[model samples]
Target: MKQLYISFILLSLSFSNSYAYQNKTTKAVDKIVVTKKTQPTKTPIKISNAIIANFVNKYPNLKTYRSDLNNLYLKRNYKSIWFGGKGLIEFANLLYAKTNELEQEGLQSKFAYKNKINSIFTEKTTKNLASVDTELLLSAMYLFYAQKVYKGIESDKIKEIGWLIPQKNLSYATLLSYLLVDPKALDKNDTAQFNQYYKLREVLKKYRKIEQNGGWNKIVRDTLVFELKPGDSSQTIGQIRQRLATTGDLHSDSKSNRYDQELIDGVINFKKRNGYNEDPVITFSQISRMNIPIENYIKTIMVNMERCRWIDPEMTKAAQYIIVNIPSYKLFFVRNGKTELESNVFVGGTMNETVIFSGNINYMVFSPYWNIPTSIVQSEIKTALEQNKNYLVENEMESIKGRVRQKPGPKNPLGKVKFIFPNSNDIYLHGSPSKSLFQSEYRAYSHGCINVNKSEELAYLILKDNTEWPVERIKSAMEGGKEITCMLKEKLPVHMGYFTAWVSDSGEISFFNDIYERDDRLAEILFSEDYN
Candidate 1:
């Protein structure tokens, strides 16, 4: 019994000594951690508004962020943020590491005076020479991080790049306020940041890793001789399989040359991912796109990430709203933050590109007239009318003074119903007489408005709440007849936007072609501009 008691005492002492050593080691990143007595040093590195004012002079490049820095100190009563009674908080390392790896955020922007910040961390003794410069520098970095990662470029510059969507304007003061309460708030998913920005950041990491591993190889194809179809075997088929597997479109690469069902499925997945027709046949154009260097794909992702920065996260927070992705050629109806309906859409062609903007949907017109624009009247319909005097009668179009408008009928181009959202662009969502156009993968044939494939289903979904517009009434309304407008009880928000790369909630990343050719111009501006 005596030996057992002695053993217990020794064991407890050993554990107590080990824990003490570990606790000290954990906080020993800098010299200011603990005093000789091993009690936490309670001295706060005092900062004055004068100190902050002097900082802007030393680092005038951070002039823009002087605001959040000053606000942080004043609210904090000129105390430390990166430090505590213990010394440098552990999150300092985390923030420093993140700032170094900006590419992971799809940002090429550099933090101002990054090397000097690096020296402060590496050479800890230097903190003594300066009065709380380290503290202020870290504060400046947090503001810079928030600005680059969440708020993005200046709003006017985004508009200059042809992006008309609303920019996400963030308050650094609020961020600092949150940070003062909990330093870890900096790492949390910010409510103001467009949620997709994180998803794109995740994909950017994967693609950069792909780039590091020698990237994807280009498939050498003789256009005249190289064509892949089901049951046709070639070495090119194996290359295609490997390529699809790189992006996870294919489950596994059999590493076989045969064009089997597995390869066909991979081809379909690749096509769907790239906004191409889901056909098994592999063409030269598809291979050419595949051959586009992974570097280019990375740039596309970066450009889209910049676009995400310009989007207001709250734009989609309404009870019900619709989002039209022009490049992917699809429309999504979201209710209560869940996607309730998805429809294939055909948007404007290159020459008449659909404007990127948002508006409230207030009404829907059943069997609406196609008021042919004056440009088309002078350029097309007028010429046709001159060619054949009976063209108006043949096409069900009427001449009311100088204007030409097609009457609501079976042959009407506006299809059965058109959803109206008043905007300066004069664009809205509507149906088309030609449903076959929706089947084609390259669905950019419209003039300026969007053509929803499931107009009947959309009408039913939109008015499902109203007892007045039941299924029977909706069916009757869709029937060709005199034009009738049904005003919505509540305005539904709709946003028309452009994105060439998108990451689904399930983590599936899709890369769509830049239909409007806007990416290159935007990329040029972003790469050249100093985020500071």
Candidate 2:
């Protein structure tokens, strides 16, 4: 009995010690005491559930949401606590969608999470939401969503793939290449399309890098020695060196008359191959073409290309259309994809910069009356009247309710027929009596109106095919001294644009002076470190 009691007590003591240890272990595991450094608390944004629901409905594909998404975006409340995080996530998601790669899912998710956490800090939100960067991000997001929705239901893979292409880079060459090739062999499955899309993404990425590094902007000026035969080198080389030295091509051995003509000839041959004028005298322009920085040139191209994409692509295919390159001060009229008419135009000056826009030409006015803009009346007429009372009469001007107007005549400020496109700016394309102004490189003299030299011929050409009236009839109508609105059978599209630098149809890159100083301003805004 004593032995039994001692053994029972020993067993009970062992059980009690084991239970005590187990209890301690349970306490340690159950009550995890993590002491994190206290962070500044953010005030939660007050947003309406209705607004949240509406936003979700509008952007149904946007999977993630935050309380501040509505407040920050819809309400434009930058002070919202969750603004930064939500915006970042949205931006990251947008970029990921644009990549169209399944492999990027992991990275996209990580960014999305980081973006959410960063929003808690008010300081970060304020910094990121500065300028129009947020607007651009939102625009990109919307575009990506639209693309995805469009692609989802598309049955034709080639057609869908073609639609997926960024229209900004759809040059004549690229378009021709795509149009010529059949995308039937290319994979139509989502995975395959995604892979191909990634390949294009990679190409665009490398191209972007090359463009950013000024690869296209570098101009290498050299003279072409067309006199050289394929195998024969000496005479061709001598001619090249002579021309290089004369034209001041860089690296010309001034001392050595007997220079490497072969190298010079090779460069000339290369220039000829690249679609440049085969001139023996290499000018600065020629050199610029050779060594042009790709990034700078590409940016210029891309900007204009974006402008092109903004317009309906079908407009480009019209049988007849007019385009006024604002920066170049040139007008191009294309008929069935062929340039039928090309002319120099005088656009608005620096202070009164011509707007970049696209509009439809509704009618052409024969012997149109010049309705002076109110701004012109206030600035020019008022000042002219102050200088001389007889100024209006001397200039063949008529007074109409405290406003001066010019009568339509050869000597009138507006030469003849005016192509009127109703716009808020009260600007139009008209013939100019002062045709000499068009010859000037810096032609910005008009009061926010475009002056076309061959307006009559242009009008006749535009109306000839579609209208019943012959050129003689149109001339007679103008000669009758009456303003008649000739309605076009087919309303043509007009694109007035500003592009300081552009690649010509011949593939020669050309740069023009930013007469309105717009290019510099845009460049500063686009490429500046603090712009974002």
Candidate 3:
């Protein structure tokens, strides 16, 4: 009985020693979550849920994020994510730097409690471990930065600025967990964001670098010089060469005043990218275009990046879709992840601006009679009849049930074919009888519907897989004697968008005229938070 009692005591002592030594020898990184005041030497890296609740109460600036803060801590079981046992974690420094550099994400302002947050990082005023204020402030700043960069301005505000594209539903609180695990996720262009956003981000960095390098000087046009062409020599030509070189349009700057073949090639390339007629002549107007300040370009980039954030990143994965960019006056047809065709298009006039929205191409109408809208019939047709009694006869138009209808022929404005999409706006894509307007750089003469330059080609591309409507059949249907409608096997998605700045797959950055003047309105909301 004495030996048995001794053995039992030894077994109990061994169990006690093993239990005591398990977590004691582990490092802080091994997640030895100690409660506050439990260990004198180690400041607890985890705190009570009440700590977050009380911290947000003291900081009214973070009051907007009270629920988000609570939800984050609750998910982590009240662990201090930004703080390790010794000091601030590595992600804390990265996140602080990102908050300070908000301009990279197109934000002009910092978090409201920036000064208080800075005190935690500065050596002179560094806080002790388990700093609740620092912990909570970093949490709030992370939300702000994540919302600005990953999600962008609020959905309603972007809608107020006439952005009809669908907005993303991002959970910044959930994203915090990823950053806690891997800090590098802070800068990675995750698939969650639109692909265009990353492309624009890269371009913004490149343009800012150019701005820091003194930008380009203004070219002075002399009274003696009217137009500059190849073989022409002037100081303005030298300035143009330097400007193109700075923008990566020209291979190199020779610093020569004489306009050579190299300068001519650069001029054409610049004009092509800038939505202008590709002409070698460098006129006064061209000089003005080249002289727009670099700062404006940077803001333009920022504005477009915000637009990219509003779109679903996975939108481009469609098997086939059509995208019409209003500002660029172009249409792109993509199939199997490749752009099959690109065509010039003319949008609505100022009086009847095209709506920024999306739809599905339901069917195609061949040699269809133009059913003129009531407003156009009253305003335009009546006025034409008042001026000339033979207007209807000359135009091959007839009045039908109080509405005028144009006969499908050479006289019709909607030439041979039109693509119809169901929308309340009564907008559709059609060919133009007068092709002269398509050749113009500023082709916004349409009443409302888009006038496609290559409407027949578009039809063929859309009906390529059908095998029912070959090229010859399509041609016969467009003969204007009878109207015919062909429904698509599957509806093709169509997105009418406006982007002033666009980056092609080849990294070619192009800027077009903001036809609706929308960039400023959005940029104001993004920078000023006027939506609040």
In model 3, where do residues sit more than 4 Å from their true spots? 1-53, 71-80, 83-89, 126-131, 177-183, 529-532
**152-215: candidate 3 lDDT, tens digit per residue:** 7777777777667666677776788777777767776555578888788888988999999988
TM-score of model number 2: 0.51
lDDT of each: 0.81, 0.51, 0.81
lDDT of 1 by residue, 1-532 (tens): 9999999999999989966754554343333322221123366577877878888888898887776787777776776777755667666665666666677778778777876676655543433325367778888888888778777777888777766766666777676566556755555554766788778888988898999998998887755665678998777888888898898889888999888998888889888889988889899889998889989999999988888877888887789999999999999999999998999999999899999988899999998999999988989987897899999999999988878899998788888999999988899899888888788978998898999998768888999899988888888888957898999999999998888999999888899989999999888777885543
**Predicted candidate 2 versus true structure: per-residue lDDT over 1-532, tens digit per residue:** 9999999999999989966644443233213221111232244444444645654565454434434244334433433321343333222322323233322111111222224223322233433332122332343343333233212222243232222222222222232123225322122222213222323333334445654553332222235543333344444335444444332243453433343454455456545434343444444444444444445444554333323222334556768888887767788889988988887788887677777666678888777677777887887788988999998888777888876677777766666678877777667787887877776656666667788988877888887675488878888867656667788777787777665645544443345655766544444433444321
Model 3 earns a TM-score of 0.86
**Lowest-sum lDDT 10-residue window in model 2:** 102-111
Give me the runs in candidate 1 sitting further than 4 Å from their true place.
Answer: 1-50, 74-79, 124-129, 179-185, 188-190
Please identify model 2 stretches exceeding 4 Å from their true place.
1-295, 517-532
